[model samples]
Target: MGPDGVDKKILLNAFNMNSVGHICHGLWTHPRDQSADYARLDYWVKLAQTLERGKFDGLFLADVIGANDVYGASPDAALLQSVQVPINDPIVLISAMAYATRHLGFGVTANLTYERPYLLARRFSTLDHLTGGRIGWNIVTGYLDSAARAMGLTEQIRHDDRYDMADDYLDLVYKLWEGSWEDDAVVRDARNGRFTDPAKVHRIRHDGPFYQLDAIHLCEPSPQRTPVLYQAGGSPRGRAFAARHAECVFTNSLTVDLTRSIVADLRRRAVANGRAAEDIKIFSGVIVIVDRTEKAAQEKLREYQRYASPAAGLTHFCASIGVDLSRYGPDEPIEMEGTQAMVAALESITRYNPGRPWTVRRLLELMKLGARNTPIVGSPSQVADQLTAFVRETDVDGFNLMRAVTPESYEDFVDLVVPELQQRGAYKEDYAEGTLRDRLFAGRGGQLPSRHYGRRFRYGAGEWADEAVSRQAGRRGT
Candidate 1:
């Protein structure tokens, strides 16, 4: 507790992607960085053990179905820089990691646009069952035209329409997860020779514009009927979708003021949608390098910078917001009308930091280690103070710590900063009981809460269940 005497706990999530070079472009070449071994099962297992030791809330694994070819209108730069290439499936790593650590949660990114609701529902249910309720889905809609082409489409769907499709997709999945199996559907009644009651199982019937499914959920009700819903959409339409469904939201903003505003807006939207003020926990992306003293931390950062690639960073940034920064002059400002992809993302950058607009050179500088997520290098105590103050001022629930190097970055934080944070009463000392949802939500059940739109689809629920898919379609005009 600080002067206010409020025990504010910060949720720490290890932000990583299943690739050689995830965020920090050339860090894979660092002498001690073993990121090249991402293909092996042991690498992930060791990572899981380490994070669980540090009392991290979860390990968020990012994925992309297709290559990042938007840079320079070709995939040459991306492939050469190893910028998230040779990426493997994130879901496959979860089971192995879960087997390695009992308490740590897994937030796996999955694009809802590619897979059907029924298929995706069963996969998550299986993961939830296997992880013993430690699984969470980071819902993402495909943004890359490369991904769209890979799926046999001419190009990606319109940005807002992607969210609209997700709106319908989630509605159908919710019905399958919530309405298909009654709470007590499975009964081990050997005396009566009944494994499950057929009457308790209901088929989820959905018929709408995008997809059609008329089948019961393939897997039984897992520990959590719906794995913890995590979403990372920052657009207006995205916020509305997240407000209605997401349990946790991943947020990225250039400044603290911007981040605070985004958090406030999301919470307000959630409340307006009939949820509680604290219903959605916003996790701001941050990069921290710490040591016993500020000088040591700064020295470490300098050493890491030697391996950072400014070129690759710029390449990745261009692909992210859909603007070819290489085409513009070094000092050219990125305007909204110019960007053809992730318009909402680019708008946030241009809108927030008016004094210094993001130019090609500036954007490249920001991506030296990773794009836009401001890195903080300081002594353990100083870093702790900064992080605590950030959360307090911004109303964010936690920080998603992006790794600068492999296990070393995480190891350093766990050894140094975590102790200081714990002493200051800003971080938890021990793992909490129950599912990931329960731990995050204090004592709330594993399933989505009563106010969540998903809960309305409870078995044989009101008129909404019958028309949920079509209802959302009509509302969105999709």
Candidate 2:
């Protein structure tokens, strides 16, 4: 039960990437893991079907544009470990998965830093339409310097400055998705031979330092004109950005106190921006290893650890912090400073855990599962109790379950944990009907809510702005 004594249904998203090695670095070597077949459509299709059967909320797809090359000042370690380098475009796989499942939402991460807002808006709209409004865009301003270099930049934009650029980019896309077309724009009158009423469609004009655009949306409005907006950032500036724009905020699973603080701050920031506290659903990334009994689950974890590599996890972490961990001795205390790469991640180790004095040895030991998050290993009842307490205390809406052994890890959660949570009334036994947005918000329509900052770009508001300009011009004529 929640603070209000009501059961808060836990939401789960199968957090994954279109690659062999995702969060759990070296687990791709597991015999039962089929993550290597990520290139095949059938693999994703089957995953989607399984998630639907388990009644998962969504499949959150993570993406990185370039290699993780900071460690040892090279990509060799990352390449050898298959650490997120042999990745594919996540957006292309969505339609097939959507076709296979009726209600699984796809939260795809696209770095807005390198993608043009105009084209990116159209692509999301196309997917939202194809998926019947079950599409979401995990808005990201990339942190990798390698990604910037690949996009023809010598270095990355300063950490906060990237968010600044993203702010403008979002405004331009909002104009396209929410303002360019009206609800009645499409007439589809075959007898009268008029397909659409052009007057209802308006041209959007935006001129900002980072992005400038003046065009009507290419396609007519999709079911959710703007796909469900998702953001992940825990820094002060990032929190501000998410508060203003994001409907769902992806976060890291740290200590309960730290997670609660972060969640509270996000909700407070949302309320400050004229949105309700409940508007933003928080999903923390976690790893789970479960089976029929506690002993079996512990044995499963032990078996999986044999193939895990702490060195690969360190390599991935090095790129995230923009520091080479290899320079530090095993027992030496590590000092971290601000970097263009994930500012929040660097702070997670140093700022959040004050006076803990993390060492290379401790960091490596934490990667027992070859991932940053430690696994929650237990039987169904034990895991369910822990998850319920987490939700009750942290006020987190749900979890983004990271894969330890691809299909095996996910299948375990669905069969084991889902039933236990359902029995406790902490999880949904069946999915709620409607678009992703509708299901998530329960009776709120499949569009941005009224209080959302994006809704200001809606049809009548845009038209009013144009009319006000014309009225001023008429007075000048008089």
Candidate 3:
């Protein structure tokens, strides 16, 4: 039970990416680390099985389309340290992982800026079908100018402008996922010689500012018509967009007050946007380093630090905030300007904590574990106490646990911290029944909630509002 005597369970998702270096930049060099085997399907399959054994809610896969080249205006440093370059597609790894586990959910990140809604809708639906509704999408507008250049654009659109594009993209996808097929559209009737009822399958026609589509969704309705929605934008515009559409929000906070502020703001915005206060589950990114004893944990941390690369972490950070930190002196104040990457990242250093002036020296010290986020290092009890207090005080629903040493880091959490949390009634002993959305929302159902913006595009008993509008536009030759 929580301090309020409420049995509020803390959710967990193993945060990782399909690359040698993920959040912890240089830990791939650790002797026991197995992240280099990321390309192997068996690696993910086994990892999924282990997470399911630990009763984790999901495996959140982070992805990047291009190299981290903002530092020194080249990809050399990132390539040398393997800082999220040479990253494979995250979506391709999920089906195998799902097949290997019964309950663990997969939240795969995909950038909307480079993908077509019509095709992306089909891919997610197919995964939902294969995983028995254990699928989610982390919506992101690409932050890297490298990605934009690779996509044949001169540069990324303005930061807020990308969210505007995403809004239209989501609208188009919602139509394809929810409005294209009614509940009874698919039927196996040998006598009638009909596998589907044509009348029930509606054609989606969207002529939005960023995208235009005039076709039916390719696949039939999966267990969940639309996958669970997640968003990680922390800017004002990002939060507003998330409030309107996201079922879950992923956040990273350097302090409890910041996390509390974010959690409160997200709930307030969700309610303001015509959703319930509990509509969006907020998860903070965290790293935990626990051992059988407090001294042993500290020793382990020291060992991990010897193999960590602070410069590599800086290279990754430079790309994130869209500012090159290499030019700044150790104590010089780094300016936050120019690029359209993650505005929130820049604010964290330059504005969030003014008392402690941020400098290259401070950033390197924070990256002792090769990650910007500080890890909670101690015995199981100590780690559990901090984690429980964090959730209780900040109102964050759970954590997206970043990996420091791949399976070793994950295994330690499951074996040590999970049991401690479970003993305190702060973690689930077993997963609830249903799809990813249903499980996350505690058996609400395998579809988007009735009040969600996506539901507006759903094909219900009467004429969908959009269909009526589309017909009017058609008659006017629009």
Candidate 4:
């Protein structure tokens, strides 16, 4: 509970991947683990049901187009450990899981680098329609060099440049999703045998630097024309991009002060982008190992740690921050000159602990608890108290809870921590009404509020008439 005597509810999302072993590394080898069954449809169905039973806000799926080859300058270590490679497409699993539950939302990560905006717009629209608008897109630009190479490129674009491409990409998708069709475009009039009114649907003619679409959107306006935009970019440029476009932002920070600073900066940028500061929601990555007692939780954490792969952790970090940590000495301070990913992370660490210097060894020790995000290991009430304190101190909206083991970690959270939070009124006992956007911003409405920039593009009857006329005149050189 917050100091104001009011319960501070948190938006909870289950962070998972489509691969055998995600951040937990060798936990796939665990006896009771079912992540190896990820290929089977039943695996996802069961997982989705479990999350819904716990009243989770959403199941956030992480995906990667390439292997974790950056660790040893080869894919050998990654292949041996199954660090996010051999991953199936997350989109294919959404509908199957959506079929199993009513209120659980699905946030699937898709790299916008290789995909054309036109195709992606239709794909997400179809998902939103099928899932009853419980769909969210975790927008990402390809980070791994392997991903770029697989896409027929020599190397990935510079970190900041990817965000520039994303800006254009967003513009194109927004046109297709929000501007292509009038709100009243579809009319199933049986007596007249009239379907969609052709005049109501406008063709999107875009001649952008990266993409061009001279056609109407294939799908009709979904319940949420644009799925709830979730972005997990941690760089300065990334935060700026999120501030402008994202409805929800995912981040990782070790300390509450660091999280607070990041959130403040993001909200400030949002305000600068003509969006209200409160329009964006921030969720930090966190792992909770809770039990009936603190001692039991510590025992569980120790047991889970025995399965933890430091090499796998290094591989994951290497891929994400574009740094090969193997080159640095254990005691040496990490040099962050070349990679933006390295610099961003190093800056955060330094900012968080101004007094202490971070060496390669120190960083590795930190990664023992998944990544750099804070890990809470204690009894249900103890964990809840810490979580509430973190939220109040950091000013974050909620958490993206990471799993240390397949279903066990998730099951523990659902069984222990969730009930404690519910009893304290710090977590929702039931889902809210409407779309994922509606559920997240409950009582705010089903659509992006007027404060969001996307709201400007929402087409009403003849809303774009003046702009259309102007564009037509410009084309005619008038």
Candidate 5:
């Protein structure tokens, strides 16, 4: 139970990656795990149906285009553990999942550092049309140097510079999505035999430092012209970027106070940028293991640990924070530099245990339960209570739920934990109407409201400011 009386609705998303071993590392080795079936379309379809049945908000998919070779200065360890290297494209699987469920939204992650803004925007628009607007884009600027090298770059760009590039990228996409087409452009008048009003379609001209475009948008405006933008970077630069662009922000924190502080800072930044504080939703990573009794839950946790892969965990950490953890001893403290991600990760650990210094061994132990996010091990009722308490204390909008094992971990959550949360009125009983954006901002419509910066591009009645100015000048007889 949350508090004495809490009526607020809690959003829930199933956090998964398009790979065999995601957050729980070596969990694919579990006999009951079906993560090996990630390549099969049926696995995704069945998962989508199950989530919709539980009234989950969306399925958040993480993707990576490069391998993790930062650890041990070689790719052997990462390859041996299957740590996000041999991953499939996340976008290709969404159509099949969308076909299986109508209400469930899909949040697919894509790294903007490597892809062109123009092409990426069209891909999302097509997906929005195909899924009837149940699509979201999880924006990531990438954190791995390996990804940069694989993309034909010498090395990764500086942290803040990537955000600057993303800012320009977003500006161009906004022009295409919101400015290029009028609301009534698609007349489809069969009697008049007019497919669209040619005069209503405007060409967008963007000549920025990073990107250049001088043409009309290729696709017509879909239900939600621009899909809901989700961001998952937690560093200082990352947070600043999210403040400006993210409709939903994903974070991982060990304490309620830390999470609350970060969320407050993001809201304040959003307000400073002229957007409403509530316009952006905050989702924290959470892992849960539940059983009939606390003893059983503990047993399950122990069983899962048996399959934990320390090598995979280290590989992920190395690539993320830009550190080579293999150079240090198991008990040696890591001294990393040149990256904000490293500083943030180190600070979080030090904050948790001020007296004990963080070492390679300590980090591996913590990641066994899915990175640094807190893990709840108990009966269904007990887990629900903890989740409610976490939400009440942190004021987070929802959770991006992680799993200790494949379909089994998610299955237990749906069967045991969802019922308990439903009984307590903490989780949704049923879904609301419209696209992913509509469901996320339920009372709000499918479109981005006027308050959002993206709305500045929406053409109104084929008479935008420029055209209005031209008409006024003509009337003045200049």
Candidate 6:
């Protein structure tokens, strides 16, 4: 809600990962923080119930395949401080969570680099089938060279090349998910001695530079044929890819002007790509610390900082942008090589920052909370004011709220800030009924709109996609 007394509901997702220490480098030591229980399903179950109780839009789970080991050109810093190293698979925990709570969407992050499109598509379809369409995919290309090396590659692929690969990968999956079978393909008839009609299921034939496939989709059509698409790309090439495929776009920037520019550019690109201006829901990552009073919130932040591990945070950053910062002195200027892994996050320290270019020393200091996103610490009213202002300034639909601690951080936001926003007419008092996509775009149907690239392949649409896919598949080498 604006201080001027206007009505607006801010979308909120509790940004988390399946690990002890996620974004906030070393706050696992907080007395009230039970992040150590990340390995247990009960922890996630409780978290899901809490988010649903608060009427949050989703529980966004972030994941990575490899360690953050680029700061000292070694894995010591990351492993020692437990900075996102012991991460588990986020997708595996969803069923239990979905079973525990209804209407709470799960936006799980999965890198496209390591998995095959056929297997990935089937798995997501299964999840959507099980969760009743309350799922979203945060499409990402692997960023860490450590991850690449661990997976038997000599090094990670070039920046733009990765997005190119992802473009091809998504097209194949789109066909598998959206083109393979009709909604009525399953015809259970005991008298006819048949479970499914084979004629209604089409085999998807894909041939491209990076991959080739001629196969039918393994799973039946779920509630949402394709899960809601979420992307967090900030590079021009990455943005182009996202504009083509994403339904929800996530961003993180240091300043309001830069974030606003990114949002405007994304919408303009979406429009250019034939999607409507409001097609994508752009969300900026934010850290909100709220309490009964401003001073209490400030003290809470200071206490959280007492246990922070800046080295772990910087090390994570180093691996992200492909630069080792441990050797550079305070006076040195950084040359950033931002990759597909949170391009906006990498830029916050170097290229796109509104203030002075951050030196290694300064960057280490600033990343104490592992905050690549903006952090707002204040009372409920004050936090609500800043939140409304941020939305107005950036034109982003909502936020992926990063945690300063574990469930305590979220509990405080719900207890203090949620009420204030509700009073200001800036938060939902109750969640709308439907699938995740339905909840996201209320009143709109659960399926992708006709304008979306993937929808061109729905069920029996052929020649239209046949030509378009040929051109897209040719882009494998472009």
Top lDDT prediction, candidate number: 3
Alpha-carbon deviation at 474 in model 3, angstroms = 11
Task: Give Cα distance to truth, residue 77, candidate 4, Å.
Answer: 0.9
**Of the candidates numbered 1 and 3, which has the greater lDDT value?**
3
lDDT of each: 0.86, 0.90, 0.91, 0.83, 0.84, 0.85
TM-score of each: 0.95, 0.97, 0.97, 0.95, 0.95, 0.94
lDDT of 4 by residue, 1-478 (tens): 5442434578899999988877767667767677888899998999999999999999999888888887769988888888887799999999999999999999999999988788899999999999999999999987788888999998888888888989889978887888888889999999999999999898877777777779889998899888999998877888888988999999787677778989999999999998888788889888888889999999987887777776677778777777777888888776555763434665565544676677767877876654554478999889888888878878888899888777888899999889988887888989888999998987687666776766666665233566768879999999
Candidates arranged by lDDT, highest first: 3, 2, 1, 6, 5, 4
Instruction: Compute the lDDT of residue 478 as modeled in candidate 4.
Output: 100
lDDT of 3 by residue, 1-478 (tens): 6553435799999999999999888999999999999899999998999899999999999998889999999999999999997789999999888888999999999999999888899999999999999999999998999999999999988999999999999989998888899889999898999999999999887888989999999999999999999999998899999999999899997989988998999999999989998899999999998999999999999999999999999999988888888889999976667569999989877777768689999999999988899999999999988888888789899999999988999999999999988888888889989999998998887899888888888896233875688878999999
Candidate 2 residue-wise lDDT at 41: 96
- Residue 245 in model 6: shift from native, Å? 0.6
Shift in Å, residue 323, candidate 6? 0.4
Alpha-carbon error at 212 in model 6, in Å? 0.8
Residue range 181-230, candidate 1, lDDT tens digits: 88888998999999999998987778877878889887788888898999
- How many collisions between residues are there in candidate 3? 0
Model 5 per-residue lDDT tens digits across residues 1-478: 4352445778999999888877778878888888888899999999999888888999999987677878887888878888886789999999999988989999999888899888998999999999999999999888777788899998888778888999889988988898898888889999999998989899988888898999898899999999999997777777888888899998887777889988998999999989989899999988898998999999999898888776687778787777787888999876646663334565565544456677889888777753555479999989988888877778788899887787877888899989988888887788888888888887698988887877877776232577668878999997
Worst 10 residues of 2 by lDDT: 1-10
Instruction: Summarize candidate 6's per-residue lDDT along 101-130 as a digit string, tens digits.
Output: 989999998888888898999999999999
**Cα displacement (Å) at residue 108, model 2:** 0.2
Give per-residue lDDT, candidate 2, residue 6: 36
Query: What are the per-residue Cα lDDT tens digits for candidate 2 across 280-311?
Result: 99998889999999999999999999998888
Please give the distance, in angstroms, between residue 113's alpha carbon in candidate 3 and its true position after superposition.
0.4
